[model samples]
Target: MSKSTSLLAAVALVVTGGVALADDTKVGILMDITGPIASFIPPLQNAANLAVNQANEQGGLLDGKAIAVFGDTTGSAQGAVDAAGKLVNIENVPIIMGSLMSGTTIAAAEAVAIPAGVVQISPTATSPAITDIEDNDLMYRIVPSDNYQGEVLAKMVLEAGNKEVAVTYVNNDYGVGIGQTFIEAYKAAGGKITSAVKHEEKKDSYRSELATLSQAGGSALVVIAYAGDSGGKIVKQSIEGGLFTNFIGTDGLRDEALINDIGAEALATSFFSSPTSPADNPNQGTLHELYNAAYGEGADKAFVDQTYDATFLTLLAIQKAGSTDRAAMAAALRSVASAPGEKVGPGEWAKARKLLMDGKDIDYDGAGGSYDFDKNGDVSGYIGKFVVDGNSYKQTEVMQ
Candidate 1:
């Protein structure tokens, strides 16, 4: 029932949602489209576009068609507040999918989204700090927090047989949260860290920091930073300066740009970690089919699944609310996510709408996996170990 049901439901939704859409409704997109983590946003933005397009084809929300109006966060907190302010006050969107980075997501939630009562869902912000934000249930994220990813990452590093390593993290919520967690987990797991150093992003050079980290001569270096900013530069400088050869990083460094910038030969012995779906998740294959048909084969990329799921859930919540009312939409978010009525997944938009119209509840299972949101609006998921193979990095292991 899992695979076949998902496939048939997907095909039906695709066919129904492919027709010309009529009315127009807007959903906000807050991202780092061209900032520090810029490389990650393209596929994510495409995913958002794909989901909204599919929704419109499925007859949109209520009598209005869904649209993704974007605002760049510049990959910073203040940038997020500015972008979110425009989205809430000007665009007046009921829901926003954005602030891919953790700091920006927090900023948007506290300073803009929550106060405005606009629901915000992040596709990639995974800091542990997000677990206790007082958003009054207005903020949500599709990815598991670093609280989960960090421990899983630590386990991966230890299991890889690297007992002693040096650590460097960018100075931000994403880095600090994951770094501390990895440190504690690594130490507890009988691994020894040379020293934990903090690095700032957008720096032209990290040679000094790399020198300090590799002072004691370590077998591996763990870096938790954005690829476009300090992480890629650090890896490149480390290799050229002969400070360190083997390197590791988190999702922030898991990008094609990193490999291109630093070259594959340098990262051949290194690895990075990021969140991924469970092997048994029933939605991924169908999502690939829909993605390939719309954007061409191989168009699907990182965060595409979560981006699609988050976008779908956002619009569905507004549909469930039956209005653009912010509070009502926020209240409906969990109902659309968890179970109680008809089971829904990607390409099941029409089915879901019918169920809702019939006064039945619906559970939205999507590309990433089944989302059973905890009280904090977080979910349990898997993390993958990515290693460089020739010119790009690919998932080598996925751990829950």
Candidate 2:
């Protein structure tokens, strides 16, 4: 169908017995589409769309086309709540796929999804705080928590011979969770934190913070912020001010927009740590080929694999539950995502649907990892060490 027709079809909503039309199964997709993480949205959208498209092409969802209803969490807590409200109350989605930032995801979950009892699976919200939320099994994320990422990143930095570093992180959940953990881990492992600063976002300049940190005499700056917002600006201003030369960063700062804004030459000595797939996940290669074929590029973009996996898993849960009953989603999700079932990989919707129809269990191993969700609705995954390779990043090592 044409883009216009597809959109029109999406909005042709009708209600019957408190459920949507028989020909449509709507899935809510909450994304940070227009705020600090805007640069990360496009490819991630493609990944989510790819899952919906493949499901529709394969057999559709529960006898109808799986329509993706997106709610743009404008990268703020209020925005996230509002967006999720629409998805749950207005759209009446049985399941939700995201709100990528840690702050947004937690806000939406607390204010909306949890109370509403709609299952939410975040593709990329990695804040350690999420692991401790009183979600009652309604909240989940495909990526590992930032607690893991932070510990892994500390080892990556220390292993790179940066014994002392100045730290600057945006004063958000994403930044604070990873930043504090990294500092604690770094110091515990015989590294020194010269200075640590938590700054607010959208400031025109971070020169004053840079001056203080640069004067701390650290060999490197460890930045923990979104590249589209404070993180990119800090890196750019640092270069312009001739501040610290070497940098260590977490997933938030691994964006290509950083390289584009500051140029890769400035970050030659820098490296990043991000949630990554297993080094030997052959399904990753399959997902990449299909992704590139669909969008022409960006198969390797950050969170693309995770986003696709999250969406696909949500669909699988809905299908396994046999209806849009919100209460059934939690158990259905575990049945499809946890182990001891027939193995289903990416883009195997038809095969999975057939297995479910045959009253058999299926375990969905996606491009990112085999999602064995813990009791907290979190997964264990790999963290990758990356460096700028041309305009994008290249993973140099995978740490479990």
Evaluated with TM-score, which candidate comes out highest? 2
What are the per-residue Cα lDDT tens digits for candidate 1 across 65-154?
A: 776777777777887898889889887888888678999999989999998888898888999889899888887998999988888888
Clashing pairs in 1: 17-57, 17-58, 23-65
Model 1 local distance difference test score? 0.81
- TM-scores across all candidates? 0.92, 0.95
- Model 2 misplaced regions, further than 4 Å: 1-21
Model 2, C-alpha of 161: deviation from truth (Å) = 0.9
Residue-wise C-alpha lDDT for candidate 2, range 1-400, written one tens digit per residue: 3463233223322222224467788999888877888778778878988998899889988978788888878888998999899999998999999979999999999999999999999999999999999998999999998888889999999899989899999998999999999899999999999999999999999999999999997889999999999999898899899997888899899998899898989899999999999999999999999999998988999999999999999999999999999999999999999877899999999999999988899999999989999999999999999999999999999998
Q: List the residue pairs that clash in candidate 2.
A: none
Candidate 1 root-mean-square deviation in Å? 6.6
> What is candidate 2's TM-score against the reference?
0.95
Query: Candidate 1: which stretches are off by over 4 Å?
Result: 1-23, 298-300
